[model samples]
Target: MSTFAVHLSYPSSPPGMKLVGKRYVSANAQQEGLPLVFTHYTGAHKELREPAIQKLFDLHSKRPTPAIRKAWAFAGNHGEAGVVNAGSLKSETNGLLHSLLSTLPPSSVSYRAIMFVEPSLITREMRLKHKAERRIAPRSCAR
Candidate 1:
């Protein structure tokens, strides 16, 4: 039997639905660093249609026994909007992540926080990294 790592991310919480865009990242896939399962909806339009997305969250929230809870969370940033829109896909994804994580057993990995950011947005932000942690940076460079 193989052990998998679980990670969750989401966009919004419907009135009856708890987790919405939760992702289940894996722990084994070397290429993944830590295996992850996260949901990504292109825009708000997708979030409005919550049935399929919420079901996805419910699926991940279930502990499969063999898997270990590594880490999980929700996070986002606003570009033009002055106030961060909690209703945005990015924000809702984070909310679902929180719900999925609540089901995990207490462990060291559970204590660590997960970062949720738009890949494109991060590129634009140009976050600086120190020499030692360069390996953590994404493979592609801007130029």
Candidate 2:
């Protein structure tokens, strides 16, 4: 059986690197290797959020033609005590989505899930579309 794991590492990535530093679970179940996904989400950027979300939608809509899977946004605005929020930035989102799309499973040719800490574009109405968890931390937790 394949094991599924998702690691959360907040405030670990440095600036200008382009990734949010969220740890990825290993499908091997016996391997100790993990990877990071980058996003461009910043809680404060209302302008960028809409476009980012739209871009994500476009990316995911294409199922048979190169799709996106899991993703993470880099910390855009760091809160007190080294707490940064990177859940909707373009640079970070693009990076993370690109990585996931490149490594999609053969059986599943398209995106099935999108993970983010906080997505400004996701309105309250959209939340009801799926079984998503919304909160102060990790904004968009949809699958």
Candidate 3:
């Protein structure tokens, strides 16, 4: 099977959601905080190959996963505007290399904290890298 390293982040929580003991809870008793509602931002290294990732994103963007759809519905039900918006996928070739190099003994890869940023804040190079990554094969580059 193909293995991929991915980073995901949520820029903001729903309006009524509150951080309670490291978990988000909704003001509404019937609904809980949708912490897994991370349809907004995602990043992947070249380990997954660019075209495959793009195709996956295209397919899912048109028809989001069940979890994403549920998050959208939850946002709408709570009248939380702007919680669900079009997000971007980044290609972090340099970041990926850095992450790999930062790895210590006994572990093949290093874990980096997720970064939360506004969709508008994403750089042009990141977008361009995303495009370029999609064209290259996942295993073609140095691992």
Candidate 4:
């Protein structure tokens, strides 16, 4: 499990670098090129959060993909804190799904039981479909 932070910034913009005395310092000071807006995962559940960040980065790098744009719009609609909570819930749900799929066969009754008990996975799937539909729909179309 992991926690991640996402930022929206231009791809070409240099990372938050500063000249401290004679030394230049940045988060990835030794590495060249600007860091992606959504970079690094930390916390006890960071492993879970990392993939979400990676997915967002993969979608948003160079230009904002539809999913990225939709996420941004979601944040805009819900507020920054709401987005953070949503991301955390999504990550946790993914971790649960991964654990379930990796440890249990599809035919296992326990697996089916857990899936039935946890509505988070179902909600996440519905949200994914909603995002996909939003992405496919033209911008001018009202939802």
Each model's lDDT: 0.34, 0.36, 0.29, 0.31
Single out the weakest 10-residue window by summed lDDT for candidate 1. 73-82
Between candidates 1 and 4, the one scoring higher on TM-score is: 1
Candidate ranking under lDDT, highest first, comes to 2, 1, 4, 3
For all candidates, the clash counts are 21, 17, 3, 4
Residue-level error in angstroms, candidate 4, position 71: 14
- Candidate 3 residue 94 Cα shift, in angstroms, is 35
lDDT of 4 by residue, 1-143 (tens): 12233533222212331111111122212233322221111222222334544455453454433322221111211233234345444433322212323444456333111111222345776877688675765344422
Once fitted onto the true fold, the runs of candidate 4 whose alpha carbons sit more than 4 angstroms away are: 1-44, 64-119, 123-131, 134-143
What stretches of model 2 exceed 4 Å from their correct place? 1-31, 38-40, 44-73, 80-118, 132-143
Which 10-residue window of candidate 4 scores lowest in summed lDDT?
17-26
**Local error of candidate 1 at 25, Å?**
10
> Lowest-lDDT window of 10 residues in candidate 2?
25-34
Please provide TM-scores, in order, for all candidate models, with all chains considered together: 0.24, 0.24, 0.21, 0.22
Question: Residue by residue across 1-143, what tens digits does model 1's lDDT show?
Answer: 12222222333333323332223333332232333333332333222323533443344456332233332322222221112344454434333333544655555654233535444344533545344455455333212
Name the lDDT of candidate 4.
0.31
34-65 per-residue lDDT for model 2 (tens digits): 12244444444222333444455454454323
- lDDT for each residue of candidate 3 in 25-86, tens digit (9 for 90 to 100): 22221232122222222332122233433344344445433211111111211111222221
Better of 2 and 3 by TM-score: 2
**Residue-level error in angstroms, candidate 2, position 119:** 2.5
